[model samples]
Target chain A: MTVRDPKQWRLLETGLRRAAENFAIDRALLESHQAGTSPHTLRFLRFHPSALLGFHQNVEQELNLDYIRAHDIDIQRRLTGGGAIYFAPEHLGWELFLDKAVLGTADMTVIARRICEAAAAGLSSLGVDARFRPRNDIEVDGRKISGTGGAFDGDSILYQGTVLVAFDVERMLRVLRIPAEKLSDKAIASAGERVVSLQGLLGSPPALDTVRQALATAFGQAFGALFETESQLNPAELPLYEDALAEIDCNDWIYQRNRPETEAPMREAIHRCRGGTLRCGVVLDEPRQRLNQVWITGDFFAAPRRLVVDLESALRNTALVDLERNVGRFFDGYPVQMMMLGPDDFAAAIRSAVASVPEPVDG
Target chain B: MQACNGCEFIGTLYYDPEFQIWVRREQNGSLTVGMTDISQTVAGKILHVRVRRPGTRRPAGKPVATVESGKWAGPVPNYFDCVIIEGNPAVLADPPLLNADPYGAWISRVEPTLGADLALADFLTGETAFAGYCERVRNEGIQCERRTG
Candidate 1:
């Protein structure tokens, strides 16, 4: 197999655009580039204050749509699978429009990682010591500097990411209905742990141009390809972009295609004892009949106090039936000193909490 | 390797996809599928892979393999209803084998009871695979440099 030279790829900076327009361009360019008509290209784009959810995400569960509407922030759905996100002017978006052939495979997921880690390398080039976090995040010391995802068809794929040159965690707290995210300082602190942006870490956000250059340079190095700056959209892409934007820009395009939010209940169950009151809120993936997320919070006294955090991580996206087994399995391995807190007690708290809810079955 | 038409593998593999693990079926009466290079590209140096065991009936479209990347759970599914014929427990215990040699490692052995599906066709190669890819790109909204292969 032969690889394309660096000079073969192109780069474009498509300034601020609406979410639909951006997504449509993703569709158009990925299709064209993979068809052999467009060059393997990297595009730098920006969004005007939006709260977007991954394709598989539920709106009500992932976002506070009311808050977005009131704030005049755009609400859009990304054509990728991952968590929902809040993007604003403070963030920069970067995407790759390339063929699977260039990456050398037809696997969509693999393409995302290749691009993300390369971007992570670019961040590293920027002296951020950034690293790729599995599934879909680039983090700096465990706090994400960028979050990415993609949509693909055949060989053409669109892998896009949000570079947090700057971020607004407070607005994110309001835009996404992350349960108890704003309830307290600790809760907000927890939210901060899960996300990070440039301004928050560096005191000042770098220029957008600098970040884009780092990314392009990093990707070029990763692929051993040269990137020539260009500002051109191929003819093959216009019609597809138009059609996609038309459908994507409208509410009908975004909503009414998905199952109801009630299918994924944000059910909560709590248990209290001397150790601490454990509050377990679960978002069920009804189709798979599993716990999409398990949030365990409590006023408990446990050493390596990140035990709850680890436990939450251990049980993430687990099937409900596997919940108890996972919890027991977790305790058996993790050596933690919990005063007045037993393994079974913690498991029982979560199990009973799940049972208490007559969760709405998938209709 | 090119037995079933233009079926092919691209350059150096990378682990860089979202949940970058998957199962593909080949007609050798056994599946010849594994993770793509790009999947490993972004996995940030995969620590391990946990493929499903042979004789384990993984229903169509469900995870038949579980790979761990950066301590996050990544699921790889058999695109069709499958029965594992051969899988490596050795690699399962060490996971990086999938990243080190994705195509050579061949994650699992499953015979798609329904044969290979068309949806799986795009990922796999047949005669004219490259041309088909080119067609896909032509439809996308991106400008390109000319190609002559």
Candidate 2:
């Protein structure tokens, strides 16, 4: 199939909306595009303080519901795959709806990397040194600024990401069930070390329109296409949006996967080595006996602080049995200079956390 | 078993190349469904697998199971209308088994509904299945990678 119009695409800006409405539009646009009723689109969206879960994620396992309820933050599940994220009005959401054939590649990793690189280019246009990290993140100076994911149905695909324009990191820490300590100054500082916002980096947030234009220009140059801005949904997309809203704006859809929180527990362990005390916080999936996520923070003096983040990335979604081996391989490959720390220290720290809890008996 | 374009397909099972799923008829007349090697390779590593509970009736082309990877997630569609009888506990416990040996890892078992045809014209078997899969892989420009433990 040849390109319908190689140099032309639609640019859509759906202003701030409730979480369910945004997700409804997500389904409506992707489904319509898949059915060949909608044009190739680039959409910019924002949410009014929502906590979104990945499609496959269980709500109880990923969020602090009590906090979310008290704060009146809307909770909705995303159509994409990844971890949970907190969305705010100031966060600029950008998405591209295109057919896989347009990219001339069927590999998801390659496609994600291409789109993330383009987004990184857009951020760079704001005078920030942003670069694409592996998997799905755009970071500047080793601090993540944008996180991305995608959902595909048939030939159509929707790849979307959030740009932290003027984010509230403290609220994010409260809403998501992360591995860090809860609601402490130290934890908030630790979280700040990893995530950065446009306001934090630039001293003031860029206007939403400016951010959208930069992204549009970057995507246009990347795909060699011209954007025709549309302020409303295409006529073909309205009926689909209504159908999606009817199905998605309800408790049945929002709480579809409500597993018990005990199934995924945060276990912490502190290992005292000759170098220093290394503390590890691990979110373990007891049913599958796998590490859902791992975070290490300690007083150890390891040069190149980014190494810790890289190690954490390597350990994400790793099997418990393979923890040591994977950690060993990461240390072996990375060039690090530590005063008294050895690779074994990191491995032992994680193992200590795993062994802290007794294995649950099979039912 | 036969190998085509680096993907292995069981000789006895029926395959739907368009949906990228394999179906096996059990001795008890039920059918087992799983993803093909081409599907798993294109999807990358399998991180999670969720199968529909038993006693649910679904139409053809609907999801019997959903598989997620690090970057991609989608449903494993059944080619014929059926009622799900059981989900594979082994695959649910360890999803990477689907990537390690997609042929050996069945995702769900279902009993065909009344008036549903057991043998569809698109279902392929033996050498015909192998050739069709190879052609599809070529057309999609996919290179199957050997699974590691």
Candidate 3:
């Protein structure tokens, strides 16, 4: 097999667009790259206010559609898979479309890490101490600044991430179907502790151009590629983009996986332990036997308070049966001091919450 | 079974190396398909699997189902044009089965619209083909392991 020259790459800055249009371009570019009709590229994009769902996610289960509809936020599905997110115009999106061979590995985990590290480095150059968090996040002092995911076809792959240049916690809370407690004024502060934007860290967000330049330079350094600026979609992609837009910008595509909200219900549990009380809120997907989201709160003394946040991250989208293993793996690698808490306490709290879900009564 | 670095390939099933899926022809002219063990190993801890509805006609190379793991998401593309006959409810409800038992947790049952023989000809089966498949796996440095909760 022959490899494409790493020295040649394209840099595209696709300014703000609607969710449907952005997702359509995603399909077009990925398919074009796979067909060898386009060059390896790095694209920067921004979106108008939108509530985006992961490809396999149900819009009804993931977003608070009532709020979104009232607020005029576009609802669309991402080609990539991960949890849902609220994307505002202030958020900057970056993506890399490349041949998998250039990465020197086909292992998706390794590929995600490599790209995220470079993106983290880019953010670091903009003045904060950014690091790549395992799975898919970029953080500074344990608060996430970016979240990433990927989708692949044949020999090509498209990995994308969203950088929160600025954010609106209240609007996001309204747009996403998170735990209701998070909507309270007090809990809003707690939500802020989990995610930080460039504005919060730097006092003022840098210009979008500067951020884009930093990322382009970092990627160039990492892959040893010289990026040539491209202003428009390639000829092959134009036709493809139109077709994708027609298919994607419709109710059929937006509601492709609209499972009922009843399938996912919020269940809360409180566990009393020697350390303290741990409150766990689980959004359970009963049919799939999966935990869609988990929120851990209550009186617990874990030094480097990020421990709870990171633990919660580990449990996201986790299989109920793998709860212990995931918890054990997270605790084994993390070095933190808890007043009277241990790894089992954390796991037990979540398990208790899961077990508390009432059995459905047959009609 | 042909094994390489813990990856197992059952001799009776035909394999599509590109898609990394195994196809087993059923008695009723339908076929059952699942991801190869190597693919399950690479995907790691399957999180979600959504299959196309039964009766949906899909062209070759189109997604019969989409699979998501902790870090990756991609299609389980059929190797030939086919109409989905049935999707495995067991795997749909419990995705980890893909990682725990790749062979037993078949993804979909479908009827081929194209000539089955021509499609089968493109797939690898038998001991000799398995040897070649294992050799390719070795060259790619793929290590398959069974992960259970």
- Considering every candidate listed, which one attains the maximal DockQ? 3
Tell me the lDDT of model 2 at B108.
Answer: 92
Per-residue lDDT value at A103 in model 3: 88
True contacts kept of 1: 0.00
> TM-score per candidate, in order?
0.66, 0.94, 0.95
Encode model 3's per-residue lDDT on A1-363: one tens digit a residue. 434566799998889999999999999999898788888999999999999888889988888888888999999999998989999999999999997788888888889999999999999999999999998999999999999999988778899999999989999889988777678897788889889999999999899999999999999999889999987998999999999999999999989888877788777788899999988888888886788888888887987878888888878878788888899999899899998989899889888878786423212
| Residue B94 Cα positional deviation in candidate 2, in Å, after optimal superposition | 1.3
For residue A121, give model 1's deviation from the true position in Å: 1.7
The candidates, ranked best first by TM-score, are: 3, 2, 1
- Candidate 2 retains true contacts at a fraction of 0.54
Q: Using lDDT as the measure, which candidate wins?
A: 3
* Number of the predicted model whose TM-score against the real structure is largest: 3
lDDT of 1 by residue, A31-148 (tens): 5664556678889988888888766455666777677889999888776555678888768888877765677654344666788889999988777778876567788876767887
Candidate 1: TM-score of chain A is 0.85
True contacts kept of 3: 0.56
Better of 1 and 2 by DockQ: 2
lDDT of 3 at B43: 80
- Residue pairs of candidate 2 with colliding backbone atoms: none
* Model 2: how far residue A147 lies from native, Å: 0.5
